[model samples]
Target: MNILAIESSCDDTSASVLSGDRILSNVIASQSVHIKFGGVVPELASRAHQQTISQTVEQALEEAGISLSDLDAVAVTQGPGLMGSLLVGVCFTKGLALANDLPIIGVNHMDAHIYANFIEHQPEFPLISLTVSGGHTQLELVREPFDHEILGKTRDDAAGEAFDKIGKVLGLPYPAGPEIDKLSKQGDPDFHDFPQALLHEGLDFSFSGLKTSVLYYTQDQTNDFLEEHKADICASVSKAISEVLIKKLERAVDQTGVKTVVLSGGVSANSMLRAKTEEMANRKGLNWYAPHISYCTDNAAMIAITAKFMAQRGRYADLEMRPFASV
Candidate 1:
């Protein structure tokens, strides 16, 4: 089956084409307007999506060497993202489906992240997934396709969000996760012991306290002091987040007795987390899976792959379906 997928869950407007299990093209247009604000501005993001969605989809179809009439189904991210952003994709997709008289599928953004692993590495059933993104951080138990049990989720800020917020504190650019990850490579994670929140808690994650700790630590430092210690701060902060995530994931593995574990979402791009998780998985003799760096962040390829699974289960949606902002 040929499926076209659209993902505008947040700041990036992306489209992908999948012919059966094979991805033909994945196109994304990222919005840079949020950088000045140090975060995504929802209204501006919505507007950007409006302007880019059509062209993005067109480019994807062209790159895939297909026409709208060649598509068998249309899939779109339906929720757990900015409402306006979600609406743009959903509405545009509905129009496309209507125009082509094609079947439509509504996919959960978080679920798409997990299925991203399917794009390259298909994990066995009953595996564990640690999905960390700017808006969410959660541990899920995957029993089967489309069957997800959220084991634990962030109580406040997500791990990726914490990275960006802390990066902002360090006078880094917006969407600071990548910046922090890059800087952490040059400094010592032991330079300062940033607090790791809820380390003793169960599987649930917490990063608000860590962000607060960074805030308080930098509040009294001079600009010169911050400049000198920036790399160390980034390294220490990265270490703190990575430790908490790995600890909780380890706990989940012990409790569930699942031997296959995977990492998903945007934060899966972090080198430290990837390395540490690989080590833990090796130490425990467990199978570990992570998507290629390109698939680690939001993209339509994951969404299209997810739609392929939904298609197998006959999980198509009607045009009347509405987008949601939360899972």
Candidate 2:
């Protein structure tokens, strides 16, 4: 079946066309207005989505060599994101469904992240997924397709959030996770040992303490000192976060006895985290999977692929369905 998917759960307005499990095209319109604000502004994001969603979808369809009438169903991210931003996609999708007499599939943003790995790889069942993003950090046990048991999640700030917050203290740009990852490659991870909160605790994670630690650590240093050791600081912080995430994932694997492990969400794009996950999986003789970098961040291809699974299960949404802000 051919599917048209829209993703506007955050600052990006994206659309994708999928046939079976293959993505023909994935188009994203990112809003630069939030860069100066250091984070996404809900109002601005919704406005940008409204402005670009139509054209984004058009581009996706054109690239796919198909039109709206040829689509079998329309899918969209329904929740676990900004309400206004979600509404832009949800309402727009509803209109298309109504006009073309097509079925509407409502997808969870987090769920889409997990399934994004399926776009290129066929991971075995009964797997553990470590989903790390700016808004969430979670360990999910998937016993089968679309069957997820959240093993643990962040009690406070997520891993990606920690990266950005700490990066800001180091005077990096907004959405600084990628920046930190790049700089860490050239520095020493052992330069400074940042606290890894709840490292020995339960499956739940915490990064708030780490954020505060970076804040205080930077305050005590002069600008020249910070500039001189910026890469080291970034490397150390990345080490702390990656250690906590990998440790928790290891615990989940032991507790669940799952041989296959997958990583998803925006933070999964980090080079250090990917390498650490691969190393741990190899040491344990387990299977490891992660999405291509294109699917790591927010995108409609994940939504389209996830919707294909949902469609198989006869999960469909009606016009009365409304957008939600949380899971």
Candidate 3:
């Protein structure tokens, strides 16, 4: 079946065309209005989606060498994102589905992230997924397709949130996770020790304390000191976050004995975390999987792939369905 998927759960307006598990085209238009704000503004995101979603879907279909009439179903992110942003995709999809007489498949943003690993890699069942993003950090146990048991999640700030918050404290740009990752490669991870909260605790994670620590630490330093050791600071912060994530993943593997482990979500694009995950999996002789960088963040390809699975099971959404803000 050919599916057209839309994702507007956050600042990005993306659309994708998929046939079965293969993505023909994935188009994402990100909003730059939030850059100066140092974080996403829900209203601005909604407006941006409204402005670009139509063209994004058009580009996706054109690139896929198909039109709306060729699509078998229309899929969209239904929840776990900004309400206004979700509404833009959901409503737009509903209109398209209604006009084209196509079935509408509602997808969970978080679920899409996990299933993104399946886009190119066929991970076996009974797997553990570490999903880290700006809005969420979670450990999920998937015993089978579409069956997920959340082992743990962040109680406060997520790993990506911590990266951005800390980056702001260091005077970097907004959405600073990628920036921090790039700088960390040239610096020393052991230059400064940052606290890893709840490192020995249960499966749950916490990065709020770490953000606070970075804030206070930077306050005590001079401007010259910060500029001189910016790379080291980023490296040290990345080390602390990656160590905590790997440690928790190890605990989950020991507790569940799952041989297959997957990483997903925006923060999964972190080079250090990806390397650490590979190292840990190799040492334990386990299978590891992650999506291509294109699918790591909010993209419609993941939603389209996930909807393919749901469609196979005859799952479809009603025209009256509404968008939600959380899982």
How good is model 3 by TM-score? 0.99
Each candidate's lDDT (Cα)?
Answer: 0.94, 0.95, 0.95
Which regions of candidate 2 deviate over 4 angstroms? Answer: none
Candidate 1 backbone clash number: 0
Q: Write one digit per residue (lDDT tens) for candidate 2, span 104-172.
A: 999999999999999999999989999999999999999988899999999999999889888888889
Model 3 misplaced stretches (Cα beyond 4 Å): none
lDDT of 1 by residue, 12-81 (tens): 9999999978999999999999999998999999999999999999999999999988989999999989
Q: Per-residue lDDT tens digits of candidate 3, residues 1-327?
A: 999999999999999999866799999999999999999999999999999998999999999998878889999999899999999999999999988899999999999999999899999999999999999999999998789999999999999999999999888999999999999998899999999999999899999999998899999999999999999999999999999999999999999999999999999999999999999999999999999999999999999999998998998998998999988
lDDT of 3: 0.95
Query: In model 1, what are the clashing residue pairs, if there are any?
Result: none
Error of 2 at 50 (Å): 0.6
Q: What TM-score, over all chains together, does every model reach?
A: 0.99, 0.99, 0.99
